[model samples]
Target: MEKCWDLNQLYLSFDDPQFSKDIKTLEKRLEDMKSIPCQDVHEDNLKSYLEQFNQFQDLVEKIYAFISLTMSSDTTNQDALKYSSVIETLLASFADTQARIDRWIGQFDLSQIQDSYIQEHMYVLQEIQENNHHLLSDEGEKVLAQMKTTGSSAWLKYKDQLISSMKVSMDGKDYPLTEVLNMAYSKDKDVRKKAYEAELAAYSQVEQGVASALNAIKGEAITVTQLRGYDSVLQRTLIDSRMSQKTLDVLLETMKKALPIFERYYRLKAEHLGYFQGLPWYELYAPVVESHESYPFEKGSQFVIEQFYSFSKHLGDYAKKAVEQHWIDIYPRVGKVGGAFCHNLHCIGESRFLLNYGNEFGDTVTLGHELGHGFHGECLNQQTALNADYPMPIAETASTFCETIIKNAALKSADSTQKLFILENELCDCAQVIVDIYSRFLFESRLIERRQKGPLSVEEIKDLMLEAQKEAYGQGLDHRYLHPYMWTWKPHYYEADYAFYNFPYAFGLLLAKGLYALYQQQGPSFSEIYEKFLSLTGQMSLEDVGKSVGIDLQDAHFWQNSIDMIKDDIDLFEELLKQNS
Candidate 1:
């Protein structure tokens, strides 16, 4: 009912007495955890430790989520920033404690035991044990953890500031970077081109600072991974992501094969824009068929509810409840972060979404996407806190699947022009998640490889970005107009822990597409099984989770089927272009 999300359910404000009480409780619990006779290994000790650890985890997540979510909505909020810093330091200390517990647990063979709690928490404990080989010495981990606050964490804060505060100059006027970026979707060609140019020019002011932050952040990731004995940053990320190299190898290989299809779509878009050579980077987001279809917030919610109900009453109910309960922070304002995300608070059995809504068709799809994530949270809410944490790649599955449901439903009801517009929008999304993401993966791989030697110069970073774009986009984009400073603004690149955040998007998109295709064949019964699949995400490996649903994540054929689905859309888009022309 309200425009902003109700964090009051979590906490009224930072100044809330409860917030302070929890901070003290968390600190005291950290001390209590440290004092646990963890070295004294036995069933009782393990059981007691597990119970205390669960409480500690829930408390810390509640406290930290409140602060982080607050900061995301208001980047300049001093109270949020202060609490965020405090929690970061506390969590770092907490990580050291967790590391020690992990080591102690690793020395035991608790997996052989049949305790109910152990059975319930088998995956969580086993993962810690499996990663014990990579765990640094307690002292080493503590030092690394402390260093990160000043290193990658600080860099992340700095980069967030640079982008949030950045003002793009256009035609002797200034606009927020987000406002300028939104112009790329404008129907006016000059507005898109000018916005692109202004965005590039604006980056010059913060390029040096952003470049330094990236170097520092990535440099720390490289150093920490090496200290932990990881084979590489990517390998470390895959391990943390709970994905296997075999699965990544297959997913990437499929994506590589599908590049030409996306390129064909891009070139067709270019030709439609009257650029025979290729689509200029600026025009990549330009709407192909201008539809005046706009869904205001209320209409958007109703439409999503209807479409989701067509798929499953459960999903429809969740969408209706999220809207009615004020779980979403809709619309954009100064200092709020760009993009959209659903933060699922399993600790509270609730989810909060942030959106930069602009009353466009894409905005409705984004609402579907984020709510899909919330629906995922609803599924996982039934699990204990320890088992509710799904890996990054599988994390995208439900969200993207929800988007597909709504998009397909809309396409079915639209006229020819609106259908063309919707299909083109879908293809554009698939292109980014699949094609552009490939370039980002390449860039990060090379950047990490080279970052091992030393920090990269700004010029070298730009060069790497261009080289990756050229390879991934090929002639789909006019080489001359490619974004060189792409690495600077994308928050994914600056994340120290999640090295290759790029490909997981492609993984989620393709995997969800495959799931959607399965839904098409199986019809209504598929919805029940789909929720079951989401529930297991927190408990199983990506491949095993796919196996549960009769999908082979490691098989090229499985991914290709999803790619072929996109290819069909691309074909339809091209045909639509001709019909419209």
Candidate 2:
């Protein structure tokens, strides 16, 4: 009857004997790596060095993943926080020690190291070479590592604290911002509007602290990018993401062109919701027609598994296993987080799902979505630890693809009323991921540009947000109901770890659609291709990775094909609206 997940499956606790032993072993191995003298490292020593480095990296990844995943599930865990901080300190020390070796390695002739493992380690060697200029002497790197604890990292934590403690009151009841915000999905229109207003108003209380955090994080990020000889923050992110701005540029262009198609869907929604001018922001999520049905846990579980089996027996079987093995934590309770997520326990080759299942038709789809993510990781479990983590674009591909299977199945099975609701949910999510996300991309691009001139004021940020909404939304949302507090609550804006984090979503959605389209054409044969594309995402360049499935990333046509698929949906949505209106 546990409503939330139990991490004892991953570790009894961070202080568990096994976890403690791993931490000790990890530290000792890192120190051992650092003990190798710079002069002693040569081409002949390459094999030994790699064997040691891989072991150290593997352990570090395992330990960090365990602690971080635990904290995300329940950030209130003090032991998890302590472990994260301790591991971070360990990583910095490891990096500092490796810096000395890297500098020496950079000076050595890499051609002399002929082993395939050494050759593949070129990425590490290349990174060291690229960073050699900014890397201070070993002593300086060690010292800077200490300063960063109080620098950008501290600012990030402070911002997290500021937001987490925020409260908003509505109709004389004080509620956490998360709870108040969830009211937007209520069946009552008045509640959604009032919640929207309160949510916007509550943001002003912490605007200054949040703005300061954005400034500190991005400011340090910009400085570090320049200091490390990066062309820009965008470039650094792409390098880390294994994606290119060129691919993103193609994706953005496709997004711009696809807006009008979505505008039509919004127009239809406005007509349905009784909007005279346009659909209001609060009403963007308004219920047009209800599916008016619910599925209890057992039946809902069977439906998803049964529908998924039609696509491929492998996928269906996987969903069956997820439900049967108690891999999912279903049902909502107080103190549990609001959103659903799927965390892959790669070491054990399983996944844990956290859901606030309400037995609504939408809840069934949410189950489908998270289970889809679990299957994505299941596909990856066969990969080496290093290859299991994919970049952002492909990360959502499998999940979204799985969702499509469930939704499409429901689409075919439902009565017209139910079908309308199911399709509206799909279209609404698509619209947000496409249209609203496009607006965010525009806002962040201009924000970064403006931030370079000086720190943006609260007024200026609002103005920028509104401008982006106008362009992306066009005639869809009423000017009177736009959300300017968007940048305030979206955690993506504050993290300099990735800039322009908006477009990967549009990329993933469109890419998945295109992939889904191919699957529809080829039938069961497409699953093999889909699985191959997913497998290659970790090691290959975005374009090269895509090429495995015959996708050309730089070509606007590939994106256009995906955009056209959505337009087809927009047309169907309008046709259905007419039938029901």
Candidate 3:
């Protein structure tokens, strides 16, 4: 019944005594961690360090999540902002200590470590050893970490502030930018066009500032990656993502080949909508078939629970618990960030989700997607803190897998008109993941290439975006109506550490589709294998994760098969549209 999530599980308030105590504890642990002797590589010493590190991580994650979740729902919360900066500074100060520990661990061959405790964490320890190859000198590591607190971190916060506070004016009234963006799905053509125009106009007020933030963050990423001996930012991202270059190349090549199929779906939608040139960007999310049914929060949540139940009891139970436990922040408000995300708090064995719900069927699908992320977290609960952190590419597996479950279930029960709406919505999402995401990958690749030369101006950034759109979308989008200011608002580009966040969504979608195919072939028994795959994600390479469930990520055929599934959906969508017409 509560619209807002209950943060009482984290803390009653920032001023809660437990919150203060945890901060002090985190500071104390940092000191203890710094005192660990790097010269001693014995099993006992390593075990002790691991114990202390896990404890320190637990305290830090608790404090950080409380502050971040607080700030996410209300960016103006000054206390949350202050504490966030404090926690970041503390973590940055520990970079030298971490670097020393990593270097020390790197010296030992895992086969030589005989202790059971150390062996239990062999995978993560091996990862640390591998990552040590990229570490700078201790002082350099510390300096970079400390500098980033003021550098990329500050810019990211500023960007969030600018976007969160921005308002779009239309029809003599001002609306939160998120509310207007959600209007893209409005059944009324005028509403969609007006919202799109107003949304674009509103960015001008913040475009220059957002552009500056983008340049600073990206420039920092380029410099840092080069310093770490990475050939390019994308290389560093692949290493951090626990993915290989070959895997990425195959995935992208497959998606690139499938782009024409997506473009065809786009052009067909345009024809249905009476746009002869191409689908206007504003009309991208417009509903073609009218559905009398509405998906208010209660109805949507119930639907998600039911559909998840159809998959497995464990998944069904997780959704029910998330809804009943007040773990979701469920509406758009002035200071709330746009879009949706599921933050899995391994420290508390729970996950928190944020959504901008608007009672549309698309919103229901988004709910299913985020809840899928939560289920992934649920599976990882058995692992220790460090072992629970999975790579970005594999991160979307459970969420997108959950999305497939919800969509398939809905399609089976819908009338012909509703089927068209559902099928079209699914195609639109797939296109965004496959087609729009490719455009983003191109834009960011080019953006980084140019940022290395110098900071890109606002106009130059917009031009790069348009160029990428033209190339990726081809004739699928109207050139005149393309969204030029897209870079200004997408939160993905602003994160200095996580460059190339676009491709992972495509990776996840295709991988999930592959896994979903396995589920179809294996039936109810496949649930165990799926859970096992999700559980191992945090501890294994993505290729290994796929292989755990009999899937090969590096093979071109695996990715191509996934794309063909989307192609099948396009065929069904076309047939449904014809029947409706």
Off by over 4 Å in 1: 15-17, 74-76, 165-167, 333-336
Per-residue alpha-carbon lDDT of candidate 1 for residues 1-581, written as tens digits (9 for 90 to 100): 57889998899988899999999999898898898787787777787788887787789889988988999999899998888778876777677777888888987787567679877888888898889999888888888777777789889999989998998989999898878887999999999999999999899899999999999988988888888899989899999888899999998998888889989999999999899888999999998888878988888888999999999999999999899999999998888987899999887989999998888888899999999999999999988887888888888889999999989989999988999999999999899999899999999999988988998999999999999999999899998899998987788998888888888899999999999999999999999999999999988788889998999888999999999999999989988899888
Q: Lowest summed-lDDT stretch of 10 residues in model 1?
A: 110-119
What is the lDDT for 512 in model 3? 91
lDDT of 2 by residue, 381-418 (tens): 77655556577767777788878888888888787777
Using lDDT as the measure, name the better of candidate 2 and candidate 3.
3
Residues 1-581 of candidate 3 have per-residue lDDT tens digits of: 88889889889998899999989888889998888888877878888888888777777878899999999999899999899879877887788988988999887778988888788788899989888878999999989987888899999989989997999999999998878987998889999999999999999899999999999999999999989988999999999999999999999999999999988999999999999998999989988889877899999999999988888999999999999999999999988987899999888899999999989888899999999999999998888877888998888889899999988988998999999988988888899999999999999999999998999899999999999999999899999999999898788999999899999999999999999999899898889999999999988888898899888888999999999999999999889889998
Model 2 off-target regions past 4 Å? 1-9, 36-44, 68-75, 101-145
Write down the lDDT that model 2 would get: 0.80
Candidate 2 is scored at a TM of: 0.92
Q: Candidate 3 — worst ten consecutive residues by lDDT sum?
A: 52-61
Any residue pairs clashing in model 1, and if so which? none
By TM-score, the candidates rank as 1, 3, 2
> Candidate 1, after superposition: displacement of residue 83 in Å?
2.5
TM-score of 1: 0.96
